[model samples]
Target: MHPFKMLSEYGPLLLEGAWLTIQLSGLALLIGALLAMPMSVARCSPRAWLSVPVRIYISFFRGTPMLAQLFLVYFGAGQFRHELQAVDLWWLFRDPFYCALLTFVLNTTAYQAELLRGGILGVPRGEVEAARAYGMSAWLRYRLIVMPHAYRIAFPALGNEVILLLKGSAIASVVTLFDLMGQTRAIFAKSFDFSIYLWAALLYLLITMVIVRIWRYLEKRINPHLQRRVIQAPKAVKTAVTATE
Candidate 1:
């Protein structure tokens, strides 16, 4: 069948795949954000031990390709099944979907931590100093002042990461998860039509566009300071100002 006709024929199946795509991406972002919060604080802590391991973890995960990580969890983890079973964590790691979710969570946590770390560091020292002068404790000072400012500064970049990871949930296909990409591939295997694959492509594009729209809306709402740079037109000359005064 021609690509366009095949697209119409398979529209419902592709929509199913797209729905799954949104599900996986949404889960990853929510879970990833939750995981990153503490990791960010740990990296910024004064303690070398706390920061060093986090730095290494971020370096290792972000530095490596996500596909490799998925493989490590899915195939490689089986190599350690006996050890994991001893700790009663094997069931969680053994399932392919669990492994994929775990990989997405871990990967996003590393990236989000750095975004947060940059945000925290960018918080004005004066705000913290003032908070201290007011007799607020260490935790209170950071909570009341530093975290808010730091997060606002780097939000655009973090928004980008959130969108990217959401789209990247398609890669869970490689680990045998029936995510959007995987389901599309499965359908194409039976139909033997290149156009089935094209429908899959369209499904991905549709979800991606929706994600872009959502991020644009959210980034606008979250970062008011970014609006400060809109250059205003110069006011009408003061030729009439004397009459007004």
Candidate 2:
């Protein structure tokens, strides 16, 4: 069967599923980015007490499989029905959507936090020193010098993590989110044809290609200096280098 015909039959349903996937991913990423910044900052602090828990958090999340973590938080945590009910926070845990969102947020935040921390630490010391010498306050130093460079370094790494999260959304199906992968799985079960899986794979590949293009565009915009085809050094600088040699 041709791919177009297959899509024509189930295109609407798949589109709806893909839309949900996009929605879920967007919200999860927004929430994850917000949560990750402070956690990254905490991890970089000199105080062992502050950094220790962050270390454990990133270690725990990154160490475990996301699906296992989801299962533990959803089914495992739900078992504490009485305690959770007493606290009135059970509503959040009870809803599969919330649980899935929470799981994605926490998992991705831990990952992004580590990346951000690495990016921050990777900032050039000389640039930071120059900023400080220019009467830039600590906050200003971070805001102007550190943040830009850190983000420049973290941008590609963070983009990869986002793509990983996009793919990971498929795991939400097991929890009943009925996102793209989940809906496709249901369709596949009903039809008993592998074509659904193939279609789903194509859809995922298309989405990933979009993300790749976006990352490439961002990489160019964020570092205009880096986009040069060739850089010509000035005669004075070249002469100084030759004299030093």
Candidate 3:
């Protein structure tokens, strides 16, 4: 089949797959971020017991391949199907979509937690001390001060993780989920055209570019100080130019 004709015929299938990819990646990132914050905090705790388990969790997920994690959640759990069914949770394990989601969430959470931990630790001691001087409770200090700073610091890295997760989501095809890559593979199998892969690659690139733009907009919104500097720089330069003239 001609590439354009293949696209016209299968375009809806590809779009549906792309939408699933977006949904999967977006949901995983949201859930991962939520889990990462607490894991980051626990990892930062001074007590060995508190930090050790978190450290291990982070290490295990970060060190292993995402594909292995997916299989572990999907097929590996099949080994205990009787127990899961008895508990009425087998339905979740039986679905490839849910298994892939669980794996993505857990895998992303580990990496994101470490990014958040670094961001938290990067918060200036002076600001924390100032919050303490104001008699802010620990929770208040974290909520009002530390978390704000930490997220700001972590935003760039978190954005990068989101992109990685989005690309990595293609692996969902391995378990039979008809995400973009899965659909592409199916179409290519019938058509035997290499351009189908190129089409899929372009779609992925377009999605990535859109995500990068969204991240930039968010960074501008969150860090008004940087925006202000950007706004003022040209005005300052203009003033100096006028004086010289």
Candidate 4:
């Protein structure tokens, strides 16, 4: 079959898959970011009681493969179906989409927490001292000084994390979620067409390109002071003498 005809037939399915991919990735990133904020603050706490548990959580997720995590949530939940059903939470665990979303949220939360912790630690000590010298309360200091700076420092890495999660969401296909990779596999199964995979690859690349461009734009907007300023040499003034006496 000609490529155009193939695309015309499969385009809608691919679009649907792409939308599902975006939904899964976007929600996971947003929720993970929200959860990460407080977790990160706790992770950086001086008290072991506050920090150790968070450290362990981050280690487990970051140390293990995301695919393994997804499998654990999806398949492992079945082992305790009765327990989950007893609590009326089985409906959430049994659905592959929710299971996948939960796994992504858990996994990304660990990474994002670490990123934020690093950002928080990266804040300049002098600036923090200055804030304290101004008699700012801890909450006021964090609000006016620490968090804004930490987020700015972490912004680029956070964007990269989002891209990684978007690509990694392909793993959701294993649980029968019908994301982009899953749809591509289904199309290939029906037509045995090699070109379908190429189309999927292009679609993935297109999505990635869009994300990168948007990230760059937002990064520039947030870090305007970091933007490069072009310095132009002053033009030499030309004094023309009509007639030299």
Candidate 4: misplaced stretches above 4 Å? 236-245
In order, what lDDT does every prediction score? 0.81, 0.89, 0.93, 0.94
Q: Tens-digit lDDT track for model 2 on 74-113?
A: 9987689999999898998988888888899999999999
Cα TM-score of candidate 3: 0.92
**Backbone clashes in each candidate structure, one number apiece?**
1, 0, 0, 0
Which residue runs of candidate 1 sit more than 4 Å off their true CA positions?
2-5, 228-235, 238-245
Model 3 per-residue lDDT tens digits across residues 73-166: 9999999999999999999999999999999999999999999999999999999999999999999998999999999999999999999999
With a 3 Å backbone cut-off (N, CA, C), the pairs that clash in candidate 1 are 119-150
Worst lDDT 10-window in candidate 3: 224-233
Candidate 4 RMSD to the correct structure: 4.9
Q: RMSD to native for every prediction?
A: 3.8, 4.4, 2.7, 4.9
Q: Mind giving the per-residue lDDT tens digits that candidate 4 earns over 52-160? A: 9999999999999999999999999999999999999999998999999999999999999999999999999999999999999988988899988999999999988
Worst 10 residues of 2 by lDDT: 223-232
Residue 155 displacement (Å), model 3: 0.4
